[model samples]
Target: MTQNLYIPASTGGTLMSNMPLITSIEELTAEVITDLLQAAGSLTESQHVTAVEPVSFGDQSGLLSYLYRVGLTYSDGAQGPATVVVKLPTDDPNQRGISDALGFYNRECTYYNVVAPTAPFKTATIFGQAQATDSTDFIIVMEDLGHMERIDQVIGATLPEIETVLKALAKLHAVYWGHQDLENLSSTFLPMDNPIYHAALPGIFGAGWASLKVNAPDLLDPEIIEFGDNYSTHLPQMLAALNTPTTLLHGDYRADNLLLDEEGNLAVIDFQITSMGNCAFDIAYFLSSSVTSETRAAHADQLLHLYHDTLTAEGVNYSFEDLEAGFRVALAFCLIYGVASFAGWDSFGERQQELMRSMASRTIYSILETNALDSLNAN
Candidate 1:
């Protein structure tokens, strides 16, 4: 579809113009990029600042962003493009979870030594520090993974591709488990009594599953409330079960968050939700989140083996026992996460709401109808 270019004459020289929030691409300059970098704390008081033009991509913030790609030709003539993402601010005032989540992203980089795309920021030019703008506005300068494919595109791939992601998921889970104190990992993971878990809401962790059952009764069985309560009831056991060998699990390891660079190696984005929970939560969430039921059913055994075999290969000492257990416990993880996020899509601009919710509604319907919880439990 051709973007409708706004012409001043078309509106008969109105006093106001409905230009895109960010300025036109041709107007990007070194001064603009320098200002954005400084906003994110990338430049010092003395350093020369210059920004090339910016190109933007799909981002969640309502603010339009321009990716300013520039070359810093230094005094010694060494030059390279400094890729910066410029976002002025978002319009969402009541939004929550920006700080701790960005902290988690930075905190994960501290342990995992991996670059995080979703929450990239810098306190200094050389080191990474998660910083937020005071007025719910900011820009982020990040590493550009040149020509890498997004995980979203590869998700519908053949068996081997799925295996690659599963193995990586297991490895991530195993490597970062128990590296930090639970309080530091996620207050949400600790019981509500834990004061650090203070501001956290138990809403999404399990309640939304019950609410969805209440809201969508025609499509889902009311018995889902039983499953939801079972999850809440077994919270202590679930916490105890977290004692199983842990690693840094990518909380949202869906295809959309994984990037394939020019070399086709996987680079992950979105560190905002990184947590110290059981590895299976991420594995099961990633495996189940985006696909259709027919696809999931057809590929079930093959993909399970991919996850297990990857764990086994990495010497995680996983078995069918571990996989099934993870699979079962992770079911609630998947269902509830879906329910918690449903409203976001429902209100996205009409087309966005349509596409995102259509897929999501199908996912929810399929999950309930397929008895993902029951099947995982049965296994």
Candidate 2:
């Protein structure tokens, strides 16, 4: 956990008014990696460590710890690159945060194959132990696609490119269709499964909202706060309605986690929250999160038609009208989550916190104040 007892916003001074400690972003700490490999039973004294660091990606990835890939030379000179991205849980008590985050790493390695050449998604491999004795437990060693950029950056992705990504989701969901009996079956990706919806509600509903209504009244209204409270109350029923014939959901199925190969093929990554839920969950995820709100709002119906068209092309026999109905039902769920994303991640600051608290208010308000639920009710 950040040692700092963070105020809702910066108090205009050092994060810690008194206490101070050092933080590093150098190559993987040899000691940390050594402890990791030792715990995994893969460490030999012969293996030498090179580097470790918390890296920054794009403009939005501010809080991530990206241990940059390295060269691993075995005793006999057999060598490979260390490409594991270990996302550890912070003891941060906000929500059962890192607790839920661990699921993503588990799903990625235990369920989703990182190296399988079967799909067009940016695949990643899992390592032995998720983390050391610390709260951080999920670790991933992946086939580094560092050479490629995310599809979002590669504008004008040909029909083939988009087709590849959408088809990959189809192929995955098809394989895992209705897999509830298995011991390691996937769980619902986001929705109320998120820590905020689960554990952070007290904080959000209590201090967070109370603070907002008093200090930042312009950011939210009474109805918004009510929506947040009601959403939590409605979570179980909402999730029950969402768990139709399940498909593998790439929890965060946005371009951010997708790496586009040299040939512009899509490879999905960041499966920490992979779950079994409505196939519409994945569709809602892709369209709602991947496309900008403006573009998606303008093209919502068009895109809904396209998803059914894409699914049909892949040999799945579902009618557009019906599928769109399912998707629309899921849209209220998506819109709630989507609006909340305005709080965004990638950095730790007052602005981010305010954005999150405000957006949560907006999410609450919008869900309650308008006829937004009409989409879910239309059919």
Candidate 3:
């Protein structure tokens, strides 16, 4: 059954956006959408939304959110976006619990609302967004960049693609490197050393480790298991190390979340885990998890130098050696994501499972090749 809500846009602003607040997809009626778009000044008074067709994406799309690509129709010959993407909180209780605890919903909504506009790199254009103070309820409607090329994280990204993302990252980090407004931003974008994360992530990682032992035992050998068991004990010290040289980190930077258009414009998505940390965390995670081990091994030095040089050119004075050290620390920290993926192993489809396997293997390989574990204990 289709809903035909006809409320005026003037009645909808509730601190998040002037868009109609919709907690569920069923509430996204044409009349409601028309009103919101009108309030946003995206549509003319004579134009209105006529129809909508929403298609749900799978877990491979994103584990933390319920994603949909909504096709739209306009009243007559009115011109507007042909489609838009909608993000809602995940229905899975386990994932939802983690998101709620970590403030993922608010972080993403805040990113789209504040950071995305002035970010050094391209991000999806926001059409409307609404997030509840309760943290469990939120919705974001944005431009659909599905037509852009996305590198397959399962197959791994090529050197050119990796370089492209790294360059963009350097620009982003440089802009925010020791910026004055960092303290103000902390209210919405939690610092890497936030107490809430330190309290919650250990248990989350441990849950993932326990789950992996049952479902994907082969991925973790005795050595890795030993490391996993001790991860919580070392987490505080590790996060302390990651807290310096603070800048905005995309937090979940990787191939799956990056898209490129024909004109070579790159757009990054999925800011759910955005945080304030040493930019190396983003660089290390991308190199370790998104690119193949073989590719990383062959070009690791050159790529690291590339990022450092780019940052240097932008007038940041960090040394290559210190950046390398930070990179290693971040690589050791990267295991949490791979280990955590298995917490909901049963729910992931084969594609997501394959991507996780690729990420785990690559991350471990990077850790070993760089002796990242040694950095954790470095004085």
Candidate 4:
């Protein structure tokens, strides 16, 4: 008997039906493609896939998954999508082990299967999603956003673009603000203190710091490193702060994960790190990692206030003062990525290296500006 995938149908969209777990792009036969399209309600019974061509997509830096752009043709002499994106697990044993241990693959599969349908902001529409019971094998067939322009994290976003991101985030936070339903999804969406996260934290932070110290020494301030070393001791307080009126978070909400159309409408991708957390973590992560120090300095406060006003307009009772405090605390949390990315710098190209460097620098700056360490150290 086939095991039932736990996708909730209440959110109202096409749900994956009878899709098989695909471990690699090589497994995608024409029959499989047709089945996927049919399952997503994209094709009628008369329609069938005639041909498929898979090509590598973007940077091959994703540690846990391989990405492909698949071109297709229909059997009826009809042109189908010029291309769709497919995400599959990486073959590398070490990376795969890390991903499995940390539950990254399962989290993303659950997001596409359930959470994305309920999100207020636009995200890639899933044509197919499946994962193994062990979470070692997974695949996601999604709408191709290749034609859209992606914001470059190294170059940074303009003021208007940042405002757009903040508005989108506000909508997402408002919709799920203080919703008790999040607790019901705990198995799929882990909290910050999940044992998997705890198991992986030391290695991730240690490797990231070692990399930053060796590859990009300038970005690592002595005080920042010191703060990161002691961060674990403050976990209890940090967790308490994060649990204050929880909301859904797009954990890695950076410029690189967002796509924009000509009209500047945004669509997000990469839900591998999606979780339940304070909305401030997303806000702080975006500003610190996606924007340059100068841009953040000039507009961070105004943009933060924009998020507050937007949430207020949506009937959320959160105050600007509380939001500001959360934002400050969340900056320290952003250091996790700053350190980890620097550790894995060689996996990225020169452009990504520069982006990671900027991210680390700005993250440290934000932490200091808000006296984030002091707040964490306080009773």
lDDT of 3 by residue, 1-379 (tens): 2112112222233446656568888778787667767766879999999998888875443288888888889998777888888888877777888898888887787777667766878888887887665445888888899889987888888888888999999988888787776776675678888998799999889988887778777777666677778999878877988898888888989998999889878899999898898888999999989998999999999999999999999889998988998899888888988878788888788887888777877888888888888876665
Task: List the lowest-lDDT window of 10 residues for candidate 3.
Answer: 1-10
Ranking by TM-score: 3, 4, 1, 2
Scored against the true structure, residue 165 in model 1 reaches a CA lDDT of: 69
| Reference-based lDDT, each prediction | 0.47, 0.47, 0.82, 0.77
Per-residue error (Å), model 1, residue 179: 4.8
Alpha carbon deviation, residue 104, candidate 2 (Å):
4.5
> What is candidate 3's local distance difference test score?
0.82
Q: Show where candidate 1 strays beyond 4 Å.
A: 1-49, 52-78, 86-94, 97-140, 153-158, 177-201, 205-219, 225-243, 350-379
- What is the alpha-carbon lDDT for the whole of candidate 1? 0.47
Of the candidates numbered 3 and 4, which has the greater lDDT value? 3
| Model 2 TM-score (2 dp) | 0.63
lDDT of 4 by residue, 115-144 (tens): 777776778878877766544677788899
Candidate 1, 1-379: lDDT as tens digits: 1112111212222112122223244544555544444454555444545436444464453211223343443223323335543323233321234333334323332322232211222111222122232222223344555456665422344455566667667665544434444444443233213333222334444444544455455545555556556655554444455435555455666666666556546666554455565676676676566555566667777777777776677556667877666665665546545555433433345543333443345445545644656643553
Number of clashing pairs, model 4? Answer: 0
Identify the superior model by TM-score, candidate 2 or candidate 4: 4
For candidate 2, give the lDDT of residue 233: 60
